[model samples]
Target: MRIKAYGLVEFTKSGYVKTQAVVLTLTVVLLIFALLWQPTGMWAANPVFGFLEWWVLLVLIAEVAETAIMLLKFKEKEAALR
Candidate 1:
């Protein structure tokens, strides 16, 4: 497979951008769902199903890391262009 040799390609990749956006959107949706879950059914007895409430933590962390990396990459490229 041929790969583009253009610098900073991943920064503008559509697939990667879509994946990131989906992750971020799902994170918000799940957080809202977790807030509405009553935990009165199988969720009451099963820890696995209940774990969805805690998924926001992972999502938050992932978003933070993604943001940091993007910022760092931007600055790196900025310095290179100087």
Candidate 2:
């Protein structure tokens, strides 16, 4: 695989691209719902919704960490190639 400066090659190879896309879509949908419907109260009052929100956040955080790791590895590989 060709190593690019941005390190996207490794990120895509690790298969987190699809997961990040889905989580990002879900986050955007949830944000729109919360904004248009003003469902902040419901999010807090409903256990299920609250849990959903937290779950999304947790998944997002995990994805971020995975991406960071992949980027770091890519950087190391690029450095070694130099």
Candidate 3:
């Protein structure tokens, strides 16, 4: 059978998705690095980098929430078509 899926894997395979994925991965890696580099610090020492860190976290969260909403919408659409 020709199987199909939705969400990030099948629904989004465009250039934007690739760029978003790469940026998301890099942000996560940077977050980990920042945390590791400053085990006790609440924020990065540099104010600008700290702002960037927050922006990355917010973007990551928004991406996750957006993906979940898209998956739910796709499932609803599929069900309606059935």
Candidate 4:
């Protein structure tokens, strides 16, 4: 069940934090605009939809973290056995 960091090593990271920082900045900009728009009395209002979208985003975040952790563990095991 070894998970290889081969691709990462071969491709070169330039580091994860750098790319994640860029993404977080972009997401913040979009969120700010989405939240600041003044209502024209005709704008779509759907709390349920917003809640569902947030829920899905959270699930995706959790799944990504879980997968990364699993891969880390696998790599550790592979290293330990060597």
Query: Where in model 2 is the C-alpha error above 4 Å?
Result: 2-50
- Give candidate 1's whole-model lDDT: 0.65
Q: Is candidate 2 or candidate 4 better by lDDT?
A: 2
Give each model's whole-structure lDDT.
Answer: 0.65, 0.60, 0.60, 0.51
Candidate 2's displacement at residue 18, Å, is 9.2
lDDT by residue (tens digit), candidate 2, 15-82: 55565568678776775554455237646687656566565566667767766776676568778879
Per-model TM-score on C-alpha atoms: 0.60, 0.49, 0.52, 0.42
Greater lDDT among 1 and 2 belongs to 1
Checking candidate 4 for backbone clashes, the offending pairs are none
Ranking by TM-score: 1, 3, 2, 4
- Model 3 agreement with the true structure over 21-82: per-residue lDDT tens digits: 78678879976765555433655576756566566677779877765665566567667769
Q: Is candidate 1 or candidate 4 better by lDDT?
A: 1
**Clashes by residue pair, model 2:** none
Give the per-residue lDDT digits (tens) of candidate 1, residues 1-82. Answer: 1112234445444454566688778888888888787587666888755776677767767796875676566567667769
Deviation in Å, model 3, residue 79 alpha carbon = 0.4
Better of 1 and 2 by TM-score: 1
The candidate that wins on lDDT is 1
* Model 1: residues with Cα > 4 Å off, grouped in runs: 1-9, 13-22
| Model 3: residues with Cα > 4 Å off, grouped in runs | 1-24, 36-46
Q: Residue 2's C-alpha lDDT in candidate 1?
A: 16
Candidate 4 TM-score over all chains jointly: 0.42
